[model samples]
Target chain A: MQTPASFEYERATSVEGAIASLQRLGSGARIIAGGHSLLPMMKLRLANPEHLIDINDLAELSYIREQGDELSIGALTRHVELEKSELLARHFPLFRDAENVIADPVVRNRGTIGGSLCQADAAEDLSAVCSAVKAKAVIRGAGGERVVGMEDFHIGPYVTAVGEGEMLTEVRIPLRPGGGSAHEKVERRAGDWAIAAASAAVWIEGGKIADVGVALGAVGPTTIHLSRAEELLRGKAPSEGLFAQAGEIASADCSPSADGRGPIDYKRHLASVLTTRALSRATARALHQEA
Target chain B: MHVSISVNGEQVSREIEPRQLLVHFIRETPDLTGTHWGCDTSNCGACVVQMDGQPVKSCTILAAMCEGHEIRTVESLEVDGQLDPIQMGFHEQHALQCGFCTPGMLMTARALLDENPNPTDLEIRTAISGGICRCTGYKNIVSAVRWAAEYEAAAKQEV
Candidate 1:
């Protein structure tokens, strides 16, 4: 085993201390939350920092609460917690569904929502779900705090708006008046990264789709919002023909690559299939809410 | 960096470099040879251990991050010369052949069964999906967990 060169470890007592320590370490400092994503990159020599500021002890950043009309999930909340949270099962069941299919049990036990979002892996499940839910990522940097909408968070593959010394503190998802959602994905194996996944959340009022969000994963450099697909569904009757057209639009909108999992055409086909299925299920749930 | 962790029911502290992984700390610092390191990328659960009662891939976790946590390896599964149910199930059900993935499988099973005593076959399979077994083919491992669940059920009924 190759031992990395000497470096310093600072256990930050608070988020402010963590930021200060990161500044002290200059550009070479990196924040360690769950370490699921960062440490592996370190071992593969993809990422090596001079200082590791451990922020796992900041217990305040681990909660799922209903604040105002939105559900605020702290950045450090583990995947397993989301998998079993009754609040999530009620308000944002699509997130819980996505969490259930993330990696496997051991990874879910240690992997945090913020870590996955910060890792920004294109194939990751939660990133697409966040986009589908239109969640806002509350990031705290030295300059104070700012909320970046999930759509604007990811700029490219494995890239995000998180800057130097910035820590993602919370993810706030709105509690829709007629909240109903669904998530579906096609993976090579049970716990493997998705080949392509889709999430659908819609608000239905008086038998008409009021508002809708559609997000796709593993089909582009970053999780993409299928605006054409979403526009087709919004204010529509949520019928099968509309969903089929939406799926067609989604398949055309994405730019998936021909990777080891499947061909680009097959992935686009899957994009259509999974998108229609997720939207159908989400629509069914939305109808139930209207009832 | 000086890190202290309760490993295998013993509080072992060691001064190590910042890059020292938690798996290396357990395998070298404490000299607990039961924990194996197959794939260092955290893909293979060969270095799985109960970190503060949660099963985590030690290869991906920094030793310094586990300064105050309780870690349990395969060596800690035995109590008073009696094997833990997971180990016993492995032995009685012929769950090992080369014994390389046994410790990880056992710990993963321990973590799973501790939280869910009545996991279905698919649940058990998902619980140990992180682990890779090149020898036993996972049939017996699944049987082993099922046997352990039954054994625990019987014991509870007797009590």
Candidate 2:
């Protein structure tokens, strides 16, 4: 029947109330946002939490705002919102790129950013997208709010820094000048997970790359952050050769295993090509040459 | 757990387990088998239903979480023997051969036309990307949605 194991469910009225419930219930308590990612896992019996804290009622948490030096996206924001957010498109088009390819519109309607990040599936798109944008995860708990980088936010596959009682409240993408980001993914079908996806962001200043972030999905145990490629791209002039070089670095850094998606060699090749494509597109956008 | 959800247009309360999926709840409560339960995973949109005006895969949603929300199933598409334009369009275009994916496709198309009244062929295809139709190769299904859009638009213009 593919039904989840019996558990208790309650709607959370506020973030504080949700935290309190988690505190009371301890580690066995989990929050249900859109249930697109979580419920499927639950039905498969991969996730058997004793309590599900329904956060759909927490309307105050759904928002996308540009405040101070960063763009703050609330955790409750859905995939459809990200796909349609003009503000996000203006700053980081990679979000729209990833959202369009995340899943079908029906699943996107109910899935939330918080839930996708918390699910932390290695093959998932958003984790790599967030990492390529250098976004910060805002985790709320009894100790108030703590912001952690994507590197630390994701501890491993299906594992995150969100502790027993902590809930991810928002993701903050730093507003960097001359920055453009793109996500390149090749899935087997319309809504399937990527065989290997690459997300790349480049910031150009004085015709040279000021900073860059590149990450890959479905190729490693966790979202593979190409720190070596990022370091290699900094302060370099944007060019096809440089991007290809960075792609080579990305191909070598990612640790992929063979499965239905492809052989290990094919995945590494896809990763390299996608990295180059993303970097080329990102560079074009940063230089304002995108059509 | 006791959950009260407005199904179609009626407020029906039912006692359901926390893990009970919404598809099962609807089928068992109102006896609306029109919403087919295919792929218990969210991959198949056969269980697509409107939750407060948006189409969502009911298989992945817990009925307990649907409390106080409005759910619209395919059973509500026909009113007093007058079929919804989407259903009629499907019939007219021969959109279904096996009929397993019709309900989900119809509901998904309903939501698409609601948000985007005049969806292009590409848009229609994108909207129903979650739905899998093993028959007609989706050419007829796409035409069916387009026909509904035209039908609804014409009806609006006449009004």
Against the true structure, candidate 1 reaches a TM-score of 0.96
Tell me the TM-score of each prediction against the true structure. Answer: 0.96, 0.99
User: Distance from true position, residue A179, model 1, in Å?
Assistant: 1.9
Tens-place lDDT per residue, model 2, A1-291, is: 899998999899999999999999998999999999898888788999999999999998899999999999999999999899999999999999999998899999999999999999999999999999999999999989999999998899899999989999999999989999999999999999999999999999999999999999999999999999999999989899999998899889999999987899899999999999999999899888997
lDDT of 2: 0.93
Tens-digit lDDT string for candidate 1 (A82-126): 999998988877987798788888888888999999989888889
Candidate 2 stretches greater than 4 Å from native? none
Interface RMSD of each: 1.8, 0.6
Task: For each candidate, report its DockQ versus the true two-chain complex.
Answer: 0.72, 0.94
Q: Report the C-alpha displacement of residue A237, candidate 2, in angstroms.
A: 0.3
Worst 10 residues of 2 chain A by lDDT: A36-45
The whole-model lDDT of each prediction reads: 0.87, 0.93
